[model samples]
Target: MRPLEVWLYGAGLVLSFVAIVSLTRSIVVTIAKRKIVEERKAVQQEVQKKNEELVKQSALVESEYFVEREAREKLGLGREGESVVLLSPSATEPGIAAPVPEAVQETKSNFRLWWELFF
Candidate 1:
């Protein structure tokens, strides 16, 4: 073959190699970018959920029922029409069935209650 033809073939081979390497690198970078975007979206969703939970807790803390319950339970104070009852430890003996406390009666959402009933 002529020297010019050999040099042209060599240059074509090198160009093809470079193109393949460039394409492979681009694919890897694109995949990594997509993964990063997905991770960021997941983290943002988690943060939004936490913010919603905080808002719910804030609302509950600000409610009158929560405040009154806390005051009555913690401070041993009651409203004018209410009377407080205290039971001694000995009154809750092994044979006697104790009354269920108010705190134990959790207020469940209707959805949760139905789910629990069905499931």
Candidate 2:
């Protein structure tokens, strides 16, 4: 009878430990799944926001004003009766070569450069 009682108690203890472990794992999995759902929701919201911005940009691109502005700025097109005056580059164009002023065109030898650096 004593041996039987000890066996039953040991079985009960093992069963209780298994139950606790299973419950803890289930709770952890539930929490992880909830966190995943929340992350998915946040990503979905960000995607929706990006979609809305793209829609707005698409609308702007489709508008006549944007087309006209892009044409005027990019293609150098002018409206009817609006004469496009061509202006020469005002020292800002990269292609235009200007002579460097003599004062700024000084070339120093290596020795002179070293002397200047030290002194």
Question: What is the C-alpha lDDT profile of model 2 across 1-118, one tens digit per residue?
Answer: 6999999999999999999999999999999999999999999999999999999999999999999999998899999999887655756678787655676667899999999999
State in Å the error of residue 4, model 1.
1.9
State, as a TM-score between 0 and 1, how close model 2 is to the true structure.
0.65
Give the alpha carbon lDDT tens digit for every residue of 23-92 in model 1: 9999999999999999999999999999999999999999999999999988888999989987668676
Candidate 1, superposed: residue stretches over 4 Å from native: 80-83, 92-119
Clashes of 2: 0
State the C-alpha lDDT per candidate.
0.93, 0.92
- The window of 10 residues in a row where model 1 has the poorest summed lDDT is 96-105
